[model samples]
Target: MNRFTTMRILRNIVLLLTVLTNIGCDQISKDMVRKHISYYEHISVVRHHFTLTNVENTGAFLSLGNEWPSPVREILLVVLPIIALIAGLAVILFKQGLSALFRLGASCVIGGGIGNIIDRAVRGSVTDFLHLKFGIFQTGIFNLADVSIMVGTFLVMYSFYKDRNPSPKLPA
Candidate 1:
């Protein structure tokens, strides 16, 4: 194989590996939480600062559409997300000129989306089991998939910013 062909093959393998790793971590954490923690049963992980509790969210983030009608919920939550994830995967895999960091971020977003989609499809809800409270700051109960998505979003934004405002080169 030519050098370009070999590099492309290697890149594809790395992309798939990163995405699968994110999905695996999310699924494993959720499985552990489901097996060990009962719904709403809070267990302190770090004094009053952090806690673990199980919740099955049938809606999007923060349970925003939990009360929506069945058809709307299905279309918005499952169908739309599936379509978006497919497009995201295509972009990361095919789009040229994307930095490694950008591709990694996009892969993470897709991976997390797949993880939650699996839960929603198989279990009819997404399992969330971690919460944090520090002084005046508090967070809704969340899971590893949510963390992946948030971190991925941050990385993607940072990538764009870095590209736009690149550092000046020092005199050689």
Candidate 2:
């Protein structure tokens, strides 16, 4: 195969791998939480720092806007991810000037979003286990998919920052 063909094939494979890895990690962590922890039960892994607390979030991040009716919630949670995935794929295909870091970040975000959407569609909730706490401060329970999304977002932000033009030099 020609070099271009080979590179295209490799990129496709990498994208597939990223999606599969995100899905697999999310599913496996959920399974582990289901098997090991009863719902609402908290097991402290570190004193006032971290814990495994099983939770099922029916709405989006930190259970925000959860008061919506079931139908609306499902549509918002599941349909939005599908739309985002399509848009992300389009950006990957057409945004030739996008850096590799941006592409990777987009892939990761899409993959994680799809994974959570799958859980919400099939189970009516997203499984969450990791919990963080310090002094009087605490973070909501999250899962592997959430971690992937956060990391992807950070990378995307970093890429954008790096690509920004430096301030024009004042005649020195």
lDDT of each: 0.92, 0.84
Q: Per-residue lDDT for 73 in model 1?
A: 86
Predicted candidate 1 versus true structure: per-residue lDDT over 31-144, tens digit per residue: 999999988999998997999999999998999899999889888999999999999998888888899889888888888999999998889899999899999999999999
**Residue 3, candidate 2: C-alpha displacement in angstroms:** 1.2
Q: Write the per-residue lDDT of candidate 2 for residues 1-172, one digit (tens) a residue.
A: 9997787668767866887788889888899899989999989899759999888899899897578998889678888778878888778755567787887887788778888888898898999999998889988889999999998899899889878965678996
What RMSD does each model have against the real structure? 0.9, 3.0
Q: List ranges where model 2 is wrong by over 4 Å.
A: 165-172
Candidate 2 overall lDDT versus native? 0.84
Clash count for candidate 2 is 0
